[model samples]
Target: MFGLPRPVKRLIVGAPVRADGQELDLDVQLLLLMTRLENGDLAARTVERARRGLERGQIYLDRRPSRPVRTRDVDAGGVPARLYTPQGLPPGSPLLVYYHGGGWVVGGIDTHDTVCRYLAVHAEVRTLSVGYRLAPEHRYPAAADDALAAYEFAVTGAEKLGADPEAVAVGGDSAGGNLAAVVGALAARRPAFALLLYPATDMTVRRRSRELFADRFYLTDRAMTWYADHYCPDRARRAEPAASPLLADLREFPPTYLVTAGFDPLRDEGEAFAARLADAGVPVAARRQADLVHGFANMWPLGGRFVEALAEAAGALRTGLYAGPRGRGTTGGGR
Candidate 1:
């Protein structure tokens, strides 16, 4: 405090001053401090420690097990995925293929296990949580490639999993949400709908929120830049639809359920993507958690509202995935 610069002082404080005058939820406020990511090098040890800190905080919330759902590990195309199915949903239920968010660098199946289980039981649909290849290792196109593969696996292996191929959707939070959007745009076989939770939709474009909520929020602009550096090191590739789906055409995007946290730096871009989808004549249902921060979906330590939010998202996924028809489709993975 005596010698630090203003920027360093702000990082130390880490309290968001919301433009809307809304206060952050108490649990979330505590979590922001407990899980505050380091601002230094994005080295393997640093990232690992950050991930462990997040998981440690998560243990308190994830301690309570999800409603008796059954989960099994399987290869979704070439990608590894954990499939969650409700206890008694019968065969041929809807399926939602999900990706976990970690800026395509950190996070995996275990980090999002509870979220997938909650969705499976609450939404009454099968949930396939994908473990896509991470970046600074696999880089751009790898995660996108896995997302498409996982969707294809869901479509083709539906009957085998006791799911209805036609009633399948693609969804995820943050970076994973970006993958879902890309799959929606480029997958050879279409999904029934999409659920994007505070997605990083446009890496190439910076929005006002990126600057406004940059530091205090869990997802900071500086951290985002670091993630982008790892995920899409090439400047030109950052503009590609695979990396920034917001730049892609959205005319044929399925009905979408988009959620954005008002305090999240990614807020504006996620909203802009929803607007674009709506303008393209795609059915859209968008919600903003006015007092929440980024990563709320997986941060169980934040308590009830976060749980309720997951339920709300699951409900939306159920509604969108099963809305139109009950007819079944042929099951065969597209190469």
Candidate 2:
């Protein structure tokens, strides 16, 4: 199915899917169906198999070659990371330390390369895509620890990475977003900004969206539970601020731009966190992509609404990093 031509894929997608008062993007519906046909029952797959499947799926969906961004392998603190710098970008530009989403287990640098490239090119900022340790192997707090270390590295070693030390930011999608929120709250020095995409903010409780879009949305509830069990087997510990940053104090968090998909299981929690940040007097802008699903960041190459949504996020990222402080509020738009 993934091997089909773009037009052919659209033909197969047939019609948009409507559920719970919103219509899912046709491209997203097609991708979810293909994923189901390609890899059935994600929770039943072995960890290695799940990782490979996610990487393969991302590569297939995001087929656009690298843009004008120049990339280099670098060590962020002790964590391996890839640094992307857009062509002709001047030194001392802002830097975004990014983490990839895979429920803390499946994704890596290769899986999220296209996303970083898009941000580097569109947002016009230096991007360091962190390759953090995975779970069920490294387990709880390992990824979080690496996330903070990488952010510190980006701050302290910004000159070496060709970025402005004071303008360093943290951003990521899904589980990576959780890490970004954790780093935002726990970092010794606050980041200049934060970009969280459909973050898994609170792992301790399943919000309504979790139950509403539990299946057929690219990210299933069973798979989420599987991920949580592997990443943090101690159920009680899931409530820790490191594991569930939504519960953390946000008064000192940096200005943030958070985007959530209307159909994603993590949607409600991400919005809830944004509301908490605003109530804490932090500057925040939250947007809901009403016609999308989880993992839309990797689907931008599909064009149409996917690209439009991501482009909005890129614009917000640019503004957050370059426009200085902004107002705090919740805003909604999509489709």
Candidate 3:
């Protein structure tokens, strides 16, 4: 669909992959090529430069009109947030508090506006996209603090924003996913569910995937190390469960859906966290996009595969947050 040559398509789908799963999808390969050609090493760029670069790259996606949903900017309990509401949504539909991914440094609401709009429309839920303070300025625990505050705001102030407090969920991608994990654990009352897409659950130590896919995937290990350094300059804070949620007590977490990418450097840690959540008696839906790398969720140019993954995530949101409670278990693309 991305106009990949037939031979390149065959090579992409046929390439031998890591022990975790299958080869890269042709669409992802094409997107990676385009990304490599267009962007520079993010790790080497200043935060402002990196942010501008990402925002500029974001312009390539077809900026679909949000006719089906209405968007507004608002203060989410002292944190700046953008709210997206599906047009004509019934009373008491589920509400999702979303966090954007950028290694806790670069991205903000504008960078992830499309993702929030997609969820609001496809999931038929209202979404609040938080623009938490960034790293190297706000540093360790600032974003976590903002996440907890935003969730609390959504839960307590849902009615004011035309949503149901009891139906509120929390989610994010990469660094934002890590924040969701932390918030899901520390919140006074558990959320309906947490949708984590290729999350960075553990920053305490490097996992096998980090070493194996260090430079092969879209998100390189070097960039990750740089991100971690900027976010949590103190190594001790990095080990804290609030910072590295994979080390947290997952027993009390609500229904959780974790989406990991087979080619992502963070894959193993995300899967391990899912296993830990299941082990701790939390209902889980874990899926691994064996043919995609980290951040595929935002690479709209890749087409249907990424859209299908988002649909799966939306389905998980509907099933987990809307259905009645049950025993701990998991179902999806992974164990």
Candidate 4:
């Protein structure tokens, strides 16, 4: 499958799939089929195996052309991080402190290099991708602690990193998104804005989307349970605001752009968080990509609706970070 040409891959992923009143994007459907064929069920695999598989899979999926961004390793308050600055970006530009989406066990900075680079170039902002310690080794509150530390580092060290101290943002996909939301809620100095893609907000409750699009999608129910078990072994602690940002106090959250995939199991909870943010008077933009699935942010290399969707997100990030304060209301309209 990796040897197939772009056209061949496109042709293979051209068939559409409809279920639960949502039509899955053709490319996403194809990716799902490939995932099923390659690895049966994520929960069935050992953590080591799953981590290896994700690293290998990224080599094929993250084939987007490299951007002319200058990258360097940095220590984000003791956590490993990579900083991506677009070539020609001026000093004092906006920065995004990023987190990768790997269920807190699988992915790392290398796996999400393309994502940070893409956002750096397209959003015209510097990106600092944090590599927080994984779970079952450094569990529950570990990732969250690292995330807060990293955000603080980004804010305090913005000037040295060639970023505007007042324009720093926080963002991530899935697990990363959860961290970003948590930071937005709990940080002493809040980010200027937030960009979350299909975030896992309420881990404690299995929303309808969880049961409706549980299996066959990139993120499965069993896989979620597996991740939660590894990250926060104490089931009782999953309800804590640190683990479930949807339950966090959002009264002082920064302006946010939250996007959800219609076919993603985490869809409902992500939207619910967005609604909560708006209710708290935080300016927010919420979008639902009606035809996409989970992990679409990493699928931009496929270059079709995937790139289009991500480009829209980049546009929103650029605007949110560069524009003036937005009104407090939910803005929703997505393909």
Candidate 5:
């Protein structure tokens, strides 16, 4: 179970219901429409809508304030990734390497750019977002390999970027969350932390939430199956920790922040992974966005609460990482 200590009470989350979820979450409604399109068995149109629905974050990223950061094209597991660094970093500053959520098929740096920027500035750390190749082209373990390469780059090549190689943290949302967990498993307690946002830990389709929320939840069973199928063409490979870290026995994971959406089908899996972490004696803190849906981190344009949720999550990150060096200074506040 997720232990709550003091402030954790204020940060606790509640589960979301369908009817009340309708008000004030139009993007979710639109996304639900797009998801239904995905479930209609129309591959071309569904993928097209998925692409567009994923782009809805553009409005937020566009309006987000930009800062001075170098974009260096780097290689990761044969995939290309663009690294971002804030202006004028003194040596030994911490670094955060991130992966974007697209359920393994859709997103890249472009989709997750603004959120990355806010994280870089807010956490007071250099944040690098990975541009791993998507599925239906590059399948399972491909993204994980890219994540490891990016992690290696951050750890081994820190001097060139003016960051502490030892202080790097791995994080991501959705499928990226899976990558983060598996990366931590591979790194074996090297990075300072692992921040996961509604990670898909199990590629298995038989989960209770997946069955119960087959269509009603913002993310449905059919869409999840679509993503898993695209990423895991080889049925046997799906059992690997890279594809499903929740099934893999992991020990000595880094200190972790596992965030989940209460209404998400992936919620149970993320929570389960956190429990496994603690059971394995890995330091962990799990936060569930009870009132939010999956991918609410990208809901900046939805309203103030959405942005506040991001702030809260980032604040938790800062608290978990920099609790001593600095005290609770928030960045990325312009809404």
Candidate 6:
């Protein structure tokens, strides 16, 4: 299926991660740890474990860099976020208000610093990677609120960051993708496109795919449940539009390009969200990534396809954002 060279194929599938709990691999161990955190009575326990995990730098997002990295911070309005600007500055280029993915719990700016630099260099754009406060510490609206706040800040302060406001967009993978989707919805009237990468569209956790693959998939049912629990502490938060963008009406979303990994547990929800968006007359382009598992975007060495993915994303941005002939806002004539 994936016509990669011999060694790369093995890398794609991973080293046969065993299902038996005793023979757990890194993800499985983390999965077990997260499960414990979710069910525990102590709130700080969960937050501390997540913080420790991030600090360890042993998670899926361990991509290394080969560029001159510049660090800075912007008020995610009130939410805190660190921004990474890559080497080889491209003046007045498009900006990506990126939200890092860790099911909204485990990831932050430092963990994702290399990946952001990769995107900025490969896509030739300025990416403001938002470190919106993690969940199980902050609830639903907090991260979503931070995503939007960062976006507005980018819009208001584009010149200072050396980005063009007219060419700005929003995007993320997993939880960040969900944030990007909701951010697009909330700022529909704003001049921006969306580059969603395997977004968690539905928070209800009722998709048949999840049920079927719960026990065995790359993204185990246990892991998904754990992620959701951490992202939404109380029952009420899970149902909110910020936490569950799929539950919200999609009529007002911006032009979007949603990417889904074929083997991911969230595949069905991403597909469903695309359907809903199209049904609501929103322009949407979804690419299904076959021959890959969940979290491939963050697995650079394993998949080695992040480079190609970055190129595709750049092309999508060109089509979605602009006043050019192929841009979304233009038609045969004006509306």
lDDT of 6 by residue, 1-335 (tens): 23445565455445644431223233333333443544422122466765575456345455555666577887757767666666665556677888888878777887667667766665556789888877777866778888888888888788888877777788898888999988887764454678888889888767866765565444666767787787776876777787788888778777788887655678789989999889999888988765445555565533345445655765676556544333434311111
Question: How many angstroms is residue 148 displaced in model 3 relative to the true structure, after the best TM-score fit?
Answer: 0.5
Comparing 2 and 5 on TM-score, the stronger one: 2
**Global lDDT for candidate 6?**
0.69
Candidate 2, residue 287: the lDDT equals 95
Ranking by TM-score: 4, 2, 3, 1, 5, 6
lDDT of each: 0.80, 0.87, 0.83, 0.87, 0.71, 0.69
lDDT of 3 at 30: 63
RMSD in Å for all candidates: 6.9, 4.6, 4.4, 4.5, 7.4, 7.2
Candidate 5: stretches off by over 4 Å: 1-49, 56-61, 66-70, 87-89, 324-335
Q: How accurate is candidate 5 locally (lDDT)?
A: 0.71
TM-score of model number 5: 0.81
Tens-place lDDT per residue, model 5, 1-335, is 11234244323322323532333233344445545655533123465567666675365446453556656776744666667766654456667889998888887788888777767655667777888878877887788888887888778887676676667788899988889888888764467788888899977546666665566656677778888888887888887888888877667678888888766778778898999999998888888766567777766544445677777767666666666233333333222
**Lowest lDDT block of 10, candidate 4:** 326-335
lDDT of 4 by residue, 195-285 (tens): 9999989878889999988888888988998998999999899899999999989998999999999998899999999999999999999
Q: What stretches of model 6 exceed 4 Å from their correct place? A: 1-47, 54-69, 188-191, 301-303, 322-335
Taking all chains together, each candidate's TM-score versus the true structure is 0.87, 0.92, 0.92, 0.92, 0.81, 0.78
Residue-wise lDDT of candidate 2 within 87-110, one digit each (tens)? 877787889999999999889999
Count: clashes, candidate 3: 0
| RMSD in angstroms between candidate 5 and the native structure over all alpha carbons | 7.4
